[model samples]
Every structure is written in structure tokens, then in C-alpha cells.
Target: MVRRRLGDAGPGGRGAGRSGGGYDEAQAQAGAVLRGERKPTNPLTAGQVHVAFKCHNGKHIKAESNEELRASSSVIKEPEKFEVEHSGSESIYLKSHTGKYLTVDKNGDVHASGVSASDGSVFQVLLQENGLVALRSHCGFVAAEANGRIRANRSLIGSWELFQVKDRSRRSRTEHPGHELPEPDEQDDAPAFFDAFCQVEGILTAEERYAKTHHDRTAVLFDKRVRSRRRDHMEWSFKHFYMEKEYPPSFRGCVSAWDITRVEMDADGESDTPKAEDTEDAVRPRTRSGSDGSQVVSFDGLEAGRCHWKKILQEDLTDAVRIIAAFGVPAASAADADEAAWQRLLAAQAGCKQKTAHVLVMCSSGLCKAIGPIGVDCSPWPPALDAVFAERFAGLGAGSIRLKFGALPGEAYDVDKDPVFLAWKRAAGPTARGEDWVLQHADSRLAEFEAARSDYERRRLSEQVSTAKKQLEMAREHGLPVILQLPAQDDAERCMAELLVAVFGEASQHPILLSGFNGRPKCAAAFLRSFPGMMVGFNGLLTHSKHKQSLGEVAFDVPLDRFVLESLGPQYPPADSAAGSARGSYSHPAHVLLVAEELARVKQRLPRDILRAAFSNTAKLFNLSI
Candidate 1:
């Protein structure tokens, strides 16, 4: 019902909202495209626009090849901070100083420099991640998707990150090309991939969310699930918890403190669009797809600060009503025709003691305007329903918060498309062992491992893996149950061919739990024969795409105490590491179970404690607590 007259209709074309004129396919595509050629979304940067632009003189330089001269010419203005031809500019943050970078708190990775800074500087990349192989494939699902036009404007929205891993005082080695390997002492942190994934499969998005211009492993957008009713409506959901009563005016200003719950994209068109694999349908530009798409293409902290970051991006407003029903709500827009109906919609939630989850739905166009630098509403919840909060079940506790949109086929939010496979590929492109010279290929690498059911593989160097076990023994000497990060299946499988017990000699008497890429035929049985009951029965399936961006990988196969918080959150202390955070103290399953047991005695009346005990028991029994 609103208007956004800005650019064209076609991909990479122009215009913003529909001009009251009818829809045209060609205009949509052309309008979607930007003024010139666009950059292909790539991994590495933490989602700061990573562009290598040419100056007005039409001269372009390769920062990678010519470091010195490239540093001089790279001092261009930040596009996000660009000014009009004659407009006054503001001097902020050292005028885009060199060596300045965006470091995603989630991971300790450091991308090179921004296009505005010198070539050697470090900066976050500002590009959409939907189509990229590495970023998209990292997690078990796609957390962010593009929006806008079928042609160009497709973008993303999330925390932009930047950092460099060069020798920085604390470490003696360089950062790139095998200089900094995993430390033998630290382990226990899971890779900071995406935190939690969207459960919806096959929903369409007018707007998509990105992690960073690149990848940050805080959480996965989804696990894997087939759709029972994916045909009904394509949609996604994300939740962000804000401090009750007081929050910064906008997230842009306080983004560093906020935890992004989940980002998922419904690649389909409208919610009602039939689920089909036609990639052409997904080709629409992100902006035109609606605010969801726009945010995906262009991540914004400033805009989210200005407005309250509330949006509903479904093309047909009715989609909101249908999707909210999952939470037992029903209403569309704050209209006058149905006051009673509105109350029914707002009051229709179950009264469960578990914390209520808050969700925001956006129609494509609505979300676009919400983030635009123009006029729009900027509140957490719609003003019209201000009176409805006191009595609603979903609004009871301020714990869970999320944003979602209708999805289309190939929507990253869709559960039908394998989340693990899709996310892993996006985050760590071609992780398959041998495809087109890529370190990992999708076919042989992924499928072969998935077939293995989650087993560990040891590549001949038992010294490193064996040393990790020794550390576990050291921790056990201290009465701490150790967490051993079994290497991704391949790393463990290499040792199978060895005839000498000298390699895995530690397993000669004590067997460890069989996990990670365990689908290798009889892999667990072989270990049982060698070690006898030494193996724990936990499903330790980890994707090959993992580990590269996660601390979990570095800690894998090593004792948990060896894990360190080198990256972002979801970090746990290795069983033997010096305790700093509560999470670190309770990193291992044995410690967690012990803590829960202690709580069971102290917190005798709390109902959730029983649940906690159940969880603790299972986690310790399987060694899959992470």
C-alpha cells in the first residue's frame, strides 16, 4: 500500500518501488542491475562491500599485484559513505585510514583491506553471499539470501566484519598460507559458523539476510529437513533478543553487542509461488524482491539504527497472516475494518512456561523502505498494537526474537534443500576432496563422507593427533572429563591403512568414541576391535566445509582443554584451559554434567533443571555435547 519510487525494474537497472504502472519483466531485470557491471559475491571478507572500483579517470588497479602503487590509488571514498557530487562530506574514523579493518567478533579471521584503504590494509568485504560457493556452503544451511531485482540489486544485511591474520605481536608466524597452524595446547571451541538455522524449508524471501559481506561462523541458518507443506507457503523466521525496557536507539550504533539470531532467505517469489527448481526464478534482483532482498545485497548498520529494523517483506500481505499461524497468530496490517479480529490475532498464543519467541514478518517492499534512508517507521513493534503487549503469550518474556519472509524455491531458508550441504558449500566452496582442483568437491567429498554416518579419520601424523590425546590424559589426571575433538573423518581415516599400533598406540588400551564422517564402512567396528569399548557412541558427523572458519575444527581430535576462544561466541574452554568465562568452565560434557548434577541438588525446585539434567546426561553419554 506504500510507494518507493527510486530506480528501474530490470536487473542492475534502476528505480525502487513500483511507479503505479503495471509490472514489466525486462524493466524489472534492467532496473535491478546497478549503473555498471557488478561484482560476483565472494567469500573471505566478513560482509563489508568488497569492491575494486575504477576511478573517474577510468583507471583500475589490482591491489594484489602492485602493493605500493595500489596502496596509493586505493584511497577512494567508501561507497556507503559516498557524498553527492557537490555535497559536503564528513570526516569520520581517520578518513578511511589504511590498516583499518572490520573484524567479525564471531571468528578471529582477518580479511585483507577495503577498496578505499591501501591494498595491504584490512577491511570487511561488502558483497552479497547468496551465490558464493564458500560462504554459502560453510554452515549446514544458508543463513543469508539476496533480495531486490532478478538482475543486479540483490544484496544482504548483517554485521560486516574485517580482520587480518598477519604476525601481530602475540604470534611469531605469518597469518596466511600455513603460517599459523592449530595450537597443540588450546581446544574446545566449536567453529563459529552460524548459531541456529531456520527450520522453515522452501519459503520465499523478498528480503535476504547475510552474515558479513563474507562469512562469520556464529550459527548455522538451518539443519536439514524435508518439507511436509513447503507448497503451502515459502517463508523464513529469525529472532533477536533485545535488552528489556532499554535498547540503543538503533542496532547500527550498538551492533557489536547484539547477537544476530538467524538469517535465512526464501528464494521463491511470492509466498504462494509453486515450489520449483527453476534457478531463473531466483535470478531476480534482491532490492525489488523487497526489503529482505535489499538488506541481503547491502548490509547496513546505519539504517538499522535509524529505523527500529522492523519489516514485513511478503509481496501479498496475506502471507503474513498465513505464516504467523505457526505461532497461532492471525492478523494483517493494523487496519480499521476488524478491531475484534485484530485482538483475536494478537491474543492467539499458547501460554507455555518456556520463553516466548518474538518474530517479525516483512513483505518485500515494506522491508526495503524500512532500511532505506528515507521516511519510514522506526519502532521495535508496530505502534498500532502498542496496547496488545500486556496480555500476549508470545510477548511474555523478551528472550527470543527473529525476522522472517516468504520464500521461493532454492530459498536458503527452505529446509527441503539440505542445510548442512548448502551452508557448508556456501561457506567453504568446493570442500569436496577433488573437483576442478578445488580442495573439496561436492560429489565425492561430501557424499562419500555423509555415507560414513559420522566417523573420525586420522591422517598418518599420529604425533599431532596423539599429542592431543595425551593432553586429554593430563586433564583426566586433574579429575576433568576431557573433550577430544575427533578430526573430520578424513583426518582419522588415513591411519586405518597403517599396520603399526605405534601410530594410534594410545587407542591400544582405551578406545575413544567414534564420530565425524563415520559413514566409512565398519569404521566404528574397527576401532572397537582395536580398543574394545573405548569408543563412545555419539554421532560425530561434521562437514568437511567446517573447521576452516571454526575454532571447533582446530580443537577437533584434541582434548577439549586445548580449545581456545580465538574466534567468536559459542566458545568453550578446553577442559584444562584457565577458566575465564562460565561457558569455558563448563566446556566439556563431563564438566557440564557435573555442573548440572550440582544444580540438581541446589536448584531442587526449578522445573527447567530436570530438563537440563536430561540434556546433560545425553550430552555426556555421547560426547556430542557441542
Candidate 2:
């Protein structure tokens, strides 16, 4: 029910009229110039004269021997002249001295052909500030030259569309009162190409050419100003520069968190001491003097290994200040280095003047690697370590002890293929307690297996169901908060649901943490609904991609309690000393500092109770307390 505007120009002037039926403002201005109502401000005289259209590439549009116009670099002494006559419409027709009108054929080629005005012969002239003009044909093709040949085919106005219209009638300038021509300077005649071209053939110097090529003057000036300010800020003396020692000097007197698992091997070539299980009364603390005169404390019962904590403390920390010493123990091991490390840490905690520092011992089933492939090796923790630490730490009189257990593959029920299942099977043997436990929970699946169609399929399904039940029982025995490292795959949602069902029977609201999920909304949302207290860990590298404008600019609509920043070490490239040599190699100090700064900025928007940062062994080597 709407009427179309007759004067509206279609895109690219597809169906526009030659005069004014559907001409835009630019075309209307061109019409006025062509009709002589408005004279061009350029010095070019309006009269019949031999004119040459020069392109930025030093080529001139000239009529060939066959009367076809082509762009040529070769200079010609005399060219055919044409009469500039207005067509009384939105364009002008060029009449050659030989009396043929300049027209375009069906192929968009320029040549003097028809004796009368036609749509193909009509051209709208656009004037530029640099005394250059562009001719657009009625069919919306701008006259342009490519590879030294003139063609009416370009659809956009660019460097190639510009042409230098020179008046060839310089000898008759005195006869025309208003057309006073000035002497031409070589530099003034240079065309503004402003892009890379055949520079060797051009007359401009490198500096002059660069100025024209970089047309954005404001950007260039701003960059120079920034560099100048940066130079002023970098005026530092020799005292400001210091080499990085093995440990920062400032940390010598300050209370610092140390991961004993990262301590280097002693001069005696022993990486770990003899297993603590071999000796009775292992809870007694023993001290030995190192070659550097520092006292090394070792504990057998708590599995805390040798630590140099005493040498590093100038004065005991205040009662309110606590230094955390954290390490993890695997489930299958009767003796583990992390266990010895924790015992040593706790023994040291008992001797301190103030009960300020504490020890955090993480115990996990030897299934860390079975969950999925990760950049770093996932150390396994013995299930016994969880029970032992949970029972022992309850009565510690010194600094408190925090116990954490790693959850076995919550839903990795592929019995034959899953490492956790295979390990449990081997440990339990044919007549072990695990076999009885598996049968008790997998009765329904075992009944189905007895009536399955294929023997191979039945065996696989039966083993998987058995493994699922065994894993569920393992989760129940811990009776503590568990960390669930989910597989890094798109189907994590289904895996999570299956794991929850296997562990809790239905969906008991037990506190669980899910790791290894990329910060995708759908994956996060799936965990949010099913597990109310579920903590989802995302790779810290996601911050780089999500907020490109600045560091710490990322925001998520998900609750803070459900979000966790994890895998800080693997995100950084290895130190230059071991570049490309290992996956999850040690991180450089600068890399850790950069991540710490970013996390500090991002933490402002997160909830106070949110579990802020998680680190790998390599990242743990860096000072994370800052």
C-alpha cells in the first residue's frame, strides 16, 4: 500500500535515469556542473581542447590508431583534441575533432563511435580536492585504468578511479581572460597514490613517499607521543636493576608458602628418603644439618619430607598470620613423597613459636590420570592416606590441618578401558573386597548381562556396571568434599550426570567440584542446576581470548561460587631454558607474575567466598601468595 519515491537511486545506480529520474545528491551536483550552471573550481578551462587523462601510475588515456581509448605510458607529441559539450542532462558528451562522439560499446570499452547522445556516452564527473576528477558512467561503472589500459568497469571510487585532467591549450591561455595558467613545478605535478607501487620507477624519495603512504596523520602523531612518554618513564639507574636469585631476598625474613614437593634433590643424591612405613614411632620429628648450615626437618608419620622452613624465617609470624604448606598423596601407594612432605610440614608447624602456619594435605585415588589427558602428569593419591589424614589431623595441637580427597572417575565406567577400574580390579584380585562391593550395587546390570544378545557386548556392559558401582562406594568412603576432574569434551554434561547418579544413587546434595571445562555457558549451566555447590574450573587462558581490550576485563553471568580459575601453569609457555622440550614445564617468574596481576584485577568482581585460584606444580613453584 506504499508508493515508491521516484527520485530514489537504487544501489550502485542500477536502474537510475541519466538526467534526474533517480539521481542521488552527488549525481545531482555532477548534473549541475555538466549543464554549465556550476563551473568546476579547478583551473582547467571549459572549452574545446586536446586533453589527456593521467592515472596515478603515470599512464595517459589515449585514443589508439583504431580510435579505441587505451591507457599508455609512452609519451605522444600530439593527441587528438575533443570539444567539451554539455548534454543538457546529468552528463556530458566528448566530441573528437574528427567529429565522432566519445562513446562506450556494450563491452564497456571507450572509443569514439556514435554521432548522437546515448546512455552509454553519458558520464558523471566527480571533482576532487587535488585537482583530480573521476568519471562515472550511467551504468555505475567508474572510468579506471588497470595495467596501463583504460576501462569503464570499476564499481568503487579508489586510487585507480582518480585521473589528472590536463588542459593542452596552454598557448591560447592569454586569449582567455579568466584562464591564466601558472608555470608547473615538478614536485607539484606528483600524483597522490598513497600506496605501495613500482617505487623504483617513481621520482619520490623514501621519506616523501612514506609521508604520502601513511595518510593518517593523527595516528602517526599519537604513536610518537606515546613512545616519547615511555622513553621518559624508562630513565632508571643501575641500582634499579637486579638479577633474579634462586629465591627473592625480600622473602628471607617474610613468612612464605612453600610446596615441599618442588624441593630439589639433596647433595647426597637422594630425591626421597626411605618409606616411612618401615619404621615404628614415625611421628617423632628428626632434624639434620644441610651443607649450607640450614636445619632440615623430616617427619615419617605425617608423610612430610625435609623442609628448610626454619632457616627462612627471621622471626615467627603473628598469631593471626598463617603460611600454607600444601602437597598431594596418591591412593594406591603404601608410601608416597607427598605424604612424607606433609608430615615434615606438620612437625615444623608444632615447633614454631606461634601457631600461625598450617598444612593442607590432598589425598586422592590413583585415578588422576584416568579422568583424561592433561598437559601435566596427574599424581595419584592412596585412599588410605585420606582415611589416615582425616583421622590424625582432628587432634593436632599446633597449626590446623586441612584434608582434601581427589574423587575417582565419577562416571568413567568403561571398565576394561578405564585405568581406575583396571587398577582397582588388579588391587582387589578375584577374591578381594572390591569384587563383593561391585556385585552388591550392580545386581540389576548383572541380571541384564546374563540375557544379553552378544557375548562380547554383554561382557563389556557387565564390567562397566561393576566398575560404576565400585567407584560409587569409593566416593562414599571418603565422606569429605571431593574434586571431580571432568573429561575435556563436548559430552561432559552427560558424563557429569552419569557420574552424579553413580556416586549419590539419586542426587544427594553433596559438595562437588568440576574441573577441565572450557568457560562455555551451556557446560557451566548444566553443572549449576544439578550440583548446587559445584565449583566449575576454567582454563585461565580463556581470559586472554574473552577480553582482548585489556587484562581482567572479562565478566561472566554465572554465580561466583560455581566459577574457578584453574590450570594457571599450563597456560604459560615453558621457561626459555626448556622451551619446546616438555609439556607443562616450569613457568618463568614473569609469566606467573602476569597471571597473578590479571587475577587480582579480575577478583574485584567475584564473590568473597569463591575459590579463587588453582595451580599446577610448575605454577606452584612461583610465589602465589602475592
Candidate 3:
């Protein structure tokens, strides 16, 4: 059973007389503190506040996933933060960042394991004259050991019992009546609430904030590998993404294993199905020789679109061993490298003297690869066959895989509309090795679509319309959210609305993400009308002066909860120049912060509030642990 640390001054204290009958006076003193009749010498007050504890030895106390409390980590990650809630008088409840409350076990070991405040969850704060505090339990005073574990079996106060608490109340998400001003000596990771937003302050402020706090932050990579190994090993790593342009070491986020499908237009500007070689059947032949010597074609419905699954699986298994070898984790065979296995590896890694834990995987999208393959090339196959394949894949993932539907932007055009793309298509003839041509006309491609305004309006709307309908149908059938990136065309909205209504019924609650929205305000509201749970995504376009007012209008009209922030990465840098950002200056992860600050300026809300809400919305959509 869980235990709390209420000592002689608790409810039991009302009856137990000790220390020359000071119980009544102690009770009265605690009451005074709770009622604001008296202030404790320490900074803590009656209300709840976010806080971090620094031990006498100067190490910060961190909450481990295993529930044990330890004072070992020097850097303050999310787990290190705690919410201190006033229970009564001098008694308080400490909750970990993950929502678990600190509890004392029967054996006196303190763990952040309480689901809710109950018997071993409460503790009385003993504010000391030295501006430090100690917690007392019925068993003994709480203490931090030099070995990094926390326990409450100490009978008397000692150096290990005292902890210097710093108020991090500004970061709290609870509804406090008021917040105390931060100390002047407190580190300014970004502009304080007092500072107003300005153009000059956006990116620079974000860069400074990233340098100070997020240097060790976890980042999500989409089918990309880290460029270089850090001095400290990562929790995980995999070979993923573009061979030359990989993520920087400072990149912090989650990892995704992505099966890629490139959308290409024919010379006459028609959507072409991916070549047979790009299909799953082409990569791994479906026919197998039976014992009777006849050829048999396997009809496994679950393996649709996943032509490269075996290859991916083999590489991932090999990479698991590579990570273990590189990080000096306990040896393990490739056979034991699933999610739980990876967690065990990390647990062992954390047990060592390493400063950081890294878990790397080379994939696009998020965890669990049972979703098979994802793409828009199910054509030439029967509708019934496609549906069965999609359903089987969806069932295997069990909601782990999300449907990502990317629509053409407003300026999107057929290759026939651009001489360069058209010429490239003619020369390449829908081949796989045409990326060089794409690189050559990168800037002019989107611009030329605007030049063929009439053609773009008609073609872009119909471009992926059929495939989108099919994807949405699959998503609706499986109750999976669709991360839909809409084209910039206004008709694209109408087209999507019609498709959504047709697929999921009118005004369905199907979760959808409208990513990189560069469209009109009317279209956004109309699209929202069709799917209420849809969220609009704003990318680096938020930082552009030309798109400022229009996007800002959309931001204003839409409910604040229905918006999310994104960065186009290096593709859409703040610099207006189409070329030459100079070597080593193309990194743009910090630009996400600039997007947040700009959105805050448009909404006239606190940057932190906007950032917090945006992050929460994203986490909810992605089902990520924040």
C-alpha cells in the first residue's frame, strides 16, 4: 500500500502529545500558515506551484519512470518538474510532471507512484531558518542519499534532508488564482511575460531559448537520421532520410519510420500511378514454389503497400545491435528489438554514467510499423481488394498509423504547365531517377503554377481528388485521424468538404489535420463546417509579410484550440532570398518558436499560452506524451 509522510503535526497529532505538549501550538501555527495569518520563512505558500528541488549536493531531483525518486540528473528535463499542492495547514501533496503523486512505501522508500492523493501521498513541509525545507513522514524525515535514491527513514534532520526549492510556477498548467513574479536572477530562456512582441525579437529570442533550454530537448525526426553522433550517445538511432542532408546532432524530437511515395505528374499534367517497380509486389515477388512444384501466389491482405517491410525490418534489427554496440548497452540479439526491448535497453543505459539517453529509429511517421506501407497508388487494383487491404493494414496497426493526405498548394500545377517540369518529365518519362530535375526547378515549380492560373484551378482540384476520397474512406472505416495537407486553391477546400461529406457523412467528428494551410479564410471555416474536429496547421508562411494578414485573419476567426504550429524546415527560411543562405545556416528548427511567437502576435495572446496550447493540440492529434 502507498503511504504518506504526515508526522506528529498531522491529524494524529491532535491526540498524541509530544515535545512538552507543543502539539496544540503546532496545530495552531499550521492553521495560521494555511489561513495566510503567518508566512513561512521559506518561499513556498499555501497554493499549488510548479517547483524543482536541488539537493544539498547541488544535483536536481528527477522522477524516474520506474517511480523511484532520485537526485542525480544535473539537467532539468520534463520529469524533473513537480506540482506542489497544498493539502492542509503545512501539509502538501507533490505530483510528478507525469501526473503521479509522490508517495512513501511501507518500507519507507519514496516513489512518485501515487495515482491520487491517498495514504502515503501527503507530507508536511518543515521550512527551515536556512531558507531550505525538509519533509516529514510518520516513519521519519525524508532524505536524499549520496547514491541518488530518496528515502524517508531518517529520524533526524541532516545535510541530506535539506533541499533548496526553486519556484517554477510560471510553467504550471493548473488554474492558480495568481502567480508570483519570477526572481530577477532566474534564467530568461525567452522574453518574460512583460516583454511585448516585435519583429526583431522573434527568431533571435527563439534561438536564445533553444540554446539555453532545448539543447537537450527530444525532437521528432521524420524518416531522417542524425548527421553526426554526439559526444553523448543517443537513446536510439537508425539509418533514415536523405543520405546527404541529415538532421543535426542538436535535433531533438521523436522518430518515425516512413515508407515514402513521391507524387509525380505526367508531361500532359495527369496524375500517374507509381511504377510497378515502386509497388510492393515488384520489390518482393508474390509467387512461391510449393512442395508439389507448382507456383503459388500469396494473397495475404495485411501486407498491402508494404513492399519494403522485410528490408526495413532487417535493417532495423541490425541497427538495434549497432546501437547496443555503439552505446555499450548490454548485448542483445536482433530477435529482441521491439518497443519493450528498446525500453529495457534504455533503462540499462540510464543505469550507467551517461548524461543523456537516445533512442533512434530510421523511419518516417511515428512508432509501430505494422501499418504496412502508406501511399496513394492502389489504383489498377479493384476497389474491394483495396478496401480489404486497407482494413487489414489498419487493424494490424490498431490506430498506431495515421492517414496522411497531402493536397496540392494553391499554386500547384501540372508538369505540362511548366516548361522545366514538362521537359524533365519528357526526358525522364515518369522514371524514378528524376529527382535531379526536381532539384533544378525547385523555386520556379510552385511559381509557374500561379502563371497558369486557369489550368491550375481545374487540374490541381482534380489532381489527387480520387485518391483522397479513397484515403478518407479508409480513415473513416478505421476511425484513424487524417493529417491532410490541403492545396492552396480555394476549390481544394470545396473538393475536400465534398469528399469528407461523401465519405464520413455530413459534419463528421472524424479527426483531421489540415496541414500547411495557405488558403482563404472562407475556405477554412467551410472546411471546418464539414469536419468540426479538424485542426488548421500554419507553417513558416506565418512569418511571411505577404501572408501575414490573410493567415492572421484565419487565425483570428478559427477557435484558438483548433490551430497548430509547424515549421517547413529549411525549405521556407525567414530570409526572403530564394538562394544562398550561406553554408551551415540552413538549420531552421528554432523557426518553430518564431512561428509560435508570430501566431501569438496575431492572436494578441501570451506567447507562452499560444505555445502551450499549440503543443497540447499537436500532442492530442499525434497521441504523443508531452
Candidate 4:
């Protein structure tokens, strides 16, 4: 019943909605431009254009290094660009800037790993009345999750599934001519490198010629801006001083160190591609492989001649400490000295929470005399306290801290006045440890419930109180220091903290430590206010590429005396770091040092100073002798 037009040939036509069209109209126009046959003056509106998909939430669809397509909320000005290659009137293939095609998996996950456009990569573009578009794969509609993940799993279209197609070619066509725009692979051409280098070279004086030479060798930029614009080094005034010729933002914070061994890169060639055997200890440039057999390079934060403080470059602090302990080997065999560093880091992370009848603290002695010890176990839960609390205070009061826990038949006790409760209270007092008692949470279940506080919230609270009471009893019985090991999540553990304050009274000092804190800036201030005498623990999690920027912000406010180091297991390790061959051969207790060094790197302090302060805090907390 449909009338046919010159261009309107249904699904098989080039421009189904317009007159005078061909399926290869877009391809022909692109080819003509590449062949220097014509100018792309308003080419985007004429046919298929390179575009970027911006979700309603303002995030842009990006291709991760693993080729997984996700919605990224990064603050960078540029998002990943994709070219629209039309298959039919309604179907198209989204080709990434790297030449790979976006394909949908059997599970409906989108990935930019396909080399050529195939049936899996063909997506039907459904235009909506609101000017947005929905991409339909074989399985379902492509959806953008609130967490910045992209998938094609939903059968129905929703707000999350709709994306605003941004014409990247539109801006380029009008403002920048085709020849004027640099090719993607030529972003870091010689002219750009020289421009950046000359700016640094102009600031150097005759006396600083050595620094100038060093800068020339190591100061290479793979991209225009720093890898992480928010990196601590980027914020350093010295960086601004050298690059922008400006004074530091503050004079008091401007401390400098020379004779530091920087992370060395082989300056043999202009290529910035990373070597095959780059070790974890090296601060070399990072590289990603492109689908077209080219490499894209980036620097994580190592820019030379910025006057960085002494970093633990050759060996992690723990490895260096261990090497010094082995009677000090010559520089030749030093590489073999700290072979077990990786194992130690693994052990420290895996055994972070050691369940034992007693808590023990060990101290290390060597060249780095204060390199803190491993195997500091928090006291385990006692069976007796559970029995006692169930018998005395479980079900007597309504919000009474009694009825919520549900006690046995006809059981009640004045918890404040009870002999057992009073005894535990005495043992929990600051005077028991000759300094201050700590109350740590050992339960992992509370964090799950913290996300959703249901009818069982009161029950969980009562249970936490009983555990704290029991832990105090055990610490008192064995003459152990009661350090409050709180969960990294503040909301769930905040209740436990408030309960302790309510029961024990905030007047008594209880030193607290967040065991697995991942250096979230929002959670840092809240933790400081909620727990008295609180200390933040720096762990391996903070060393991740994603958390690199946040770590500096979190570490800036923490007092040197109030921060401790932990080798907590990494929640997400990179693909290479997780390989069985790369397991224990990598960072060890040095993992703790790496965290400290990162803190120090951000705070602009010497690595040794950070290590000493952390070790001192550790010793004071556990009441251990140096």
C-alpha cells in the first residue's frame, strides 16, 4: 500500500527518508574527500558523520583498554569518537577511532573489539520523537547504566537506553578544515614535543644545566596534558614554576630535594611505547595497543625535572628494609636480595584480618630501623560474650538495646551495673593499655545491611554492641590492646561507632582504624568526625590508576601521626598483574611502602620520612618497642 519514491526504497535503500539517494552516498562522500576531490563543507548533515554517543546522564560512551564499551563520566574535554558506517537504511556499524567496530556479545554486552563490521556489529538505529536515538542489537536495546557501564540487555527502550548522537564531524567541518586537523596517530608529533620542551628549557639557569639535561632525557609528553590532570605532581607549584614560569601557590609547602633517583626510561628512541619487560618498580610511560597496529602512550604522573622528593624507585620500602637486614649486599647482587618482597606484600594483604585468640605486633630492625612489621592481628571474637549478652541484655527493652537482640525466656540484667559488663568496661578503658583502648569491628555483614537499613537494623546494632562488649572482655582477659578495627564503609560502621560512644561514653579515648579504606575523599571527613582518635590506613587499593587522583586529596588532610600503612589486597588488579606468572613476583610489603610513597608523592615529602612516621604510629598504637 506504500508509494515508492526515488530514494525511499524501504530497508534496502541508502536514504530511506529522503529523495535521490544511494546506499553508498555516505561512503562515496567520504572517499571523495579522502581523494581530494571535494571539500567537506557541511558534510555531517549531508550524510554519515563521525559521532560520539552522549547518554542522557551527560556521560559519553567510551571504549576501555580491554575493548569493553562503557559510559565514562571522566571530566576530560574529549570523548571517544566513533564513525558511522551505514549498512542499510536503518542499520549501521559504530567504528571506534581506533578502527575497531563495536560488536554485541551473546550476553548483550557491547565491546569495540571487532575488526570488521559483521552481523553482531550491525545495530538498528531507531530515531525517537525527542531527537535521541536507541541502538538495537540482536539481543536487545543498548543501555547505559548509572554506574557508567554500557550494555545491550534490555528488551524495551528506556531513558538509560537512549543516547544523544553528537556529530563530531559537524564542528570539524565548519571550524576546522579536513587538512587542518591533525591525524589521531600524529597527536604527539615533533612540533608539539618541541613546543612543550622549549617551555621547560627556557626556565633553566646556567647552574641548573644538569636539570635541563635530565629534563630533556626524561620529560616527554605522550599527550598534551598530564595523564591524570588531578595528579599531585600536576598541582605542585614547582611544576607550574618550570612550565608556566610562576611561583608556587604557597611558600610554606614548597620543600625540595635533590639526589633523588627518578624512574628512568631508555631515551634511545623517540617511540614512547613501553618495553615488554617493564617492571612494576619503573615509572615508565604506559601504552595501549590500537586495532590498526599502532600504539597510544600516556604518562601516569612521572614528568622529569619537577624536583620530586626521593621515591622508592629501585625497591619498595619493605624490600629495601629487608635487603638492609640481610647484612647489606653489594649493588651488583642487590636485585636478588629482595626476591621475597612480592610474597610479603601478598601475605600482608591476604592476612590483613588474622583471627587469633591474641593480638600480636612485630617490629623490624635494619638500616631503615623503623620499617614497621607485618602480622599485626586484631583480637578475635570471644564465645563467652555472646552467651553473656544473650543471657542478660537480649530482649528486655524496646529500643532498650535489649529486646532487639531477642534474649532467652525470662532473662534480664541491668547491663550497666552487671559485674561482667562492669569488668569488661574497666578492661576497655584507655588506662588498660596504658594509653587508649581501641574498639574494632570484625563483622563484614554490617556493610551489606548498611546499604539498605531495613527492619533488622536494630537487631544488627544490638549484635554489634554484644560483639564489642565481648571483644573488650577477651582483650581484658588476655591483657591485649583493643584497637577498634572499623570497616572501610562509614555508613554501616557509623552506627557501631555511635553505639560505642553511647555505651562507653565519648569521654574515654578509643583509637580507631578503618581496615580497608579505599581513600574516598567524601568518606574521609565523615570518618574523622564520627570516630574519636581515628587513624586512616593507607593500603594497596589506593595505588590503582582509578584512585590515583583521589588518593592525593585524601592523604592531604590526614596528620602524619594519625595515618598508618596497610598492604590490603587490591580489589581490582590490572590484566597483567593478575596473571599467575606475575603473582608473587611483584610488589610485596613494598606494597605498603608504595602506598606510603604515593601519599608522600602527593604530599611532597621524602619517602623515608613517611615510612618513619607510619612506623612510629604503628609502634605507638600497638605499644611495641622500636
Error of 1 at 354 (Å): 41
Higher-ranked by lDDT: 2 or 4: 4
Question: How much is 58 displaced in model 1, in angstroms?
Answer: 53
Runs in model 3 with CA error above 4 Å? 1-259, 262-463, 575-588
Clashes per candidate (backbone, < 3 Å): 190, 19, 28, 11
Q: Give the TM-scores of the predictions, in the order they appear.
A: 0.18, 0.26, 0.36, 0.27
* Residue lDDT tens for model 1, 1-626: 00011111132112113364222432243334433244433333222223332221112212222121121121222321211111112111111123333111222222223344332222223333222221111111111111100011112332111111111112336645568754321111111111111111111121123221223331123111112112222322222111111111211110001111112223321132322551322432222122212232212221122112222222232221211111110011111112332222222221222222222232222121100000011112322212332232122110111111112211222221232434454676665432332334434433322222111111112123333333233323322222222333432333331311433343443223232222232333243334432322221111112221121211222222111111011123222112212221212111222222222222222323432333333234223222
Best by lDDT: 3
Candidate 1 stretches greater than 4 Å from native: 1-210, 214-463, 487-491, 494-519, 529-626
Worst 10 residues of 2 by lDDT: 192-201
Choose 1 or 3, whichever is better by lDDT. 3
Q: Candidate 4: worst 10 consecutive residues by lDDT?
A: 189-198
Model 1 lDDT at residue 332? 14
Model 4 Cα shift for residue 412 (angstroms) = 41
lDDT digits (tens) for residues 1-626 of candidate 3: 00111111232222233465333444355456556565456555535388888775445689998888998754455777889888778888899988999999878999888889986888888887546789887668888886678899898998889887866666433434476554323224332111010111122122222332233322212101121221112101123321122222212232122222211122342322223343322322243222122232322211222232223223452211111111111111111123433342333223333433322222221232111111121122112223423433322110111111011222234443343444456677766455676676655644433333323233322334554564465555544556555546544455556666777777677667676677666566666655677787776676677876567666765677887765534345543211112222232333455567667756657677876677566656555443
Q: What is the lDDT of residue 302 in candidate 3?
A: 17
lDDT string for model 4 (1-626, tens) is 01112112233322234445332343355456556565423222336477777675445688777888777632212336788888887788888867899999999888988988899998888876545688889989999876568889898998888876755653454566564564432112101100000111112221132222234432322122232322333322233332242111111110011110111112231222234344323544444331112232223222233221212111232211211110111111111122232222222222224432111111121122111111112223222224423444332222122122111112232233222333455677745542121123212212212212222233334344444443344333333333343433434344444544554445334544444455245455454544455566666555566655555456665678877765432222211122112321222222343466566655557666776677666555444433
